[model samples]
Target: MSLDRPAGKVPLLELEGLVKHFPFRDSLGRRRGAVHAVDGVTLAVPRGSVLAIVGESGCGKSTLGRVALRLVEPDAGSLRFDGEDLLALRPAALRAKRREMQLIFQDPFASLDPRMTVEAAITEPLILHRLHRGRERARVAELLERVGLRPELARRWPHEFSGGQRQRIAIARALASEPRLVIGDEPVSALDVSVQAQVVNLLGDLIRDLGLTFVLISHDLGVVRQVADRVAVMYLGRIVEEAPAEQLFLTPRHPYTRALLAAVPGQGGALKLLEGDIPSPVSPPSGCRFRTRCPHAQALCAEVVPELMGDAGRESAGQAAHLTACHFQDSLPPATPIREAAADARLARLQSFFSTNREPTA
Candidate 1:
């Protein structure tokens, strides 16, 4: 649970102007406007580090992950992996390149085949990649042990394992290829709180031990804080802020980023609760997508789009690279600390009551 930074080197994944739109159709199949699921996303994943893409639901983080793996074809973008053009690759070549990149989905049960045994499931990738073929069973046992599961559990089916176990199996499958890059789209969100911590630690260990580059997509800031070396805050299919995890959390530049940090429990700050529902992506606001709900929005915000820029005044190298996409980012009012003694007392009483009344574990 240390907040130490990752020592990542060269870029493993490079994406520029990535765009993916899902078009809507009428009853008669008439094409209508498209859903801007992913729009102009530009990012880089450094080798042997974890970069987290976080935002509210439907901000296109999931779609961006799938698009990175080519699970969903992007309409427009430049994707380069390890100095090779991903978009220019043929089908057969792309299939071969997949061994270098893999995805760990959110729901372990849904992603895994119910009928497949643990051995069959974990070894499928090994078989596909034609690795350790003659001794696949032994390799499966090794992978099981690597993920903190017993070798004998290879005989068990998906139904017999707990939620965390299933996720471990999924992780093993992803690692069976010995991929250089792994994209985890809400991989730990489905597990219980206690189980979530175990999986998070497991992933952190795997990434460090295997020298893997990770892109974690999640809405949970707490989870992001645990594993990410860097973070990108997305809104309406665009990244509004990108910075080192500690710097971003300590001094958030964008108003939206500040609002999100304020919402976390015990993180005392003025809670600037965002007003109104998120606008439909199909017809997002013309200029700043978040202007509709931004407290500091002005007439200029509606007429011009702000580009993501690094902080010019920050002296620290890491803080200097903190990017924020707001025209008046420097002018935004600082958030005051929340001071509600009565509320804090009430919350403490409620927590104590819950702890006393909780059911004992077996």
Candidate 2:
């Protein structure tokens, strides 16, 4: 993806301090509490770029994507799409703007309407936008082939196709309205490994072929590294680190970011074993959200929150100069154990630590 921007080119999408909270009700229908699904998320995606948001489940990545696209309203903050204020839009205007933004969900099996034929599924968006009328039939047929499905499959239901093909159909439907932005939330997580690659490759081809800006939410590091131009690491409800794909892979700054990298299937060789588990989002630890899981935690780490991940300069020794957030500047080295042996190492270390350490306090 092209990184250079024209002198005055505005980002295709921007979210400043976006926040979302889902309220939970008791049996009496009284508001009991709220789930902080997304909090203070800020990001910008340039035109024709793919920005992948990576984090474990329940880290608020998907919620941020939905809020960015206005699929869900934010509790606070700004969302601008194509220079228009998303939260400020009226219902009718927002509905109209929906044509420019679409979402590709995670589940290919359950996301589709079982009763609808492939033709109807792909043409619904086109019909809603009034982009094509009597032409929808022909267009559906063409889209089927464009997504690598035969025209004969148009009459069939979603259950009739393989997972990969269904995902392709989903892609076709997302493209039906000729949207400018597509938020793909774990688009291939539900498919087989090989099929996952197929879907990812298809998305990569589509993004390049159509010049579409994508906000990809995924937990798959390999896929993100391959398909994303830039990557954002989210923890709890905030972004801890972000950088170009190559840079992040080569060097991650925040302790949380390091732990996340270590957790990747083959990233362990790049660092020592990670220290702890990610804290529950509902009750995140005080100060640095990641301190509870970070091995580098110290008195100050628990008192002062780290900034966004960036490179070394003022940050701790291990942090990259451009890394956005890091509290310790120059003392704490990065934890890179190389990933191949991570699982075995982690297991061995866990066994040894448990054997040597005292029992947990109840």
Candidate 3:
């Protein structure tokens, strides 16, 4: 179901200056260093619309989702949901808010308990929130049907269902609270290609029918393209680009954004391949974290970290905002012919060297 208009609406959930760091210490429990899991992320999920957070694995995409629910306590930042401070809420208040928000994890198989029956699984949240009893079992069956599963299947164990069916059960559990917001973390990535589409469409239907807001975290660009109203592209621990789905697919401003788009299969009529590995987050490159791999990068890109700034000329001048963190957004600057070319030459030479070194046996 498509949103009527994605702009001019207040976000159901908002994050400002959000930061989370994990501690890794020496043997004596003394501080060693911190993993910069999520760094200064600020974004929003508009009421009744889907906002997709797309990035490669370990970019803290999952961590950000957990932080949104206060599942993992962050080292710093502000989180607000419908005008209430999420972080400032006490334990009991937070639990009450939990009823309004729920997360659908990435792996259905891993998320569900093998020991519990489908009915028990979905009913667990009900019990935790004190929502049901003897007669409510019939309602559980209704939810299963709503998610396109048979009510009879509820009596079976998690292992009895196919991958797609198990995921349906997971969705049933997430909807148990009749939550206002649903955070799906790579909800369909684990399923077969055909199954992936079915689940995606199901989610879209649920969002529209229930008037639910979604914060989707995914690496499947195609899925994101299919379901997202707006998109945020992450690198390392920060959002480097954010814009409406159509605008991002068409006129991506950042070179890193362009290069990331390089891997999108179709599109990119004659662009180069994505050139390098994401640097280790522990000791990320100076300036733009993506500068090490971005093809159009210059010396200045390596020296000064560009902040997320919007181009004055983008499509949504009034409502939609497009922000890109790259100094070269205004113009493709001159390059220093990075050491990458030399490395490429060496790789070709090495491949040829190994080919020649192989003896042609008689």
Badly placed stretches (over 4 Å) of model 1 are: 1-10, 266-270, 315-320, 335-362
lDDT of each: 0.87, 0.82, 0.83
lDDT of 2 by residue, 267-325 (tens): 42544566657676666777778777777778887777776645444447543235455
Off by over 4 Å in 3: 1-9, 132-134, 266-270, 315-319, 333-362
Candidates sorted by lDDT, descending order? 1, 3, 2
Give the lDDT of residue 149 in candidate 2: 83
Model 1 per-residue lDDT tens digits across residues 81-113: 987889999999999899999999999989999
TM-scores, all candidates, are 0.89, 0.87, 0.86
Question: Candidate 1, which ten residues in sequence have the lowest lDDT sum?
Answer: 1-10
How close to the true structure is residue 89 of candidate 3, measured as C-alpha lDDT?
Answer: 93
Candidate 2 TM-score to native = 0.87
Model 1, CA-based lDDT = 0.87
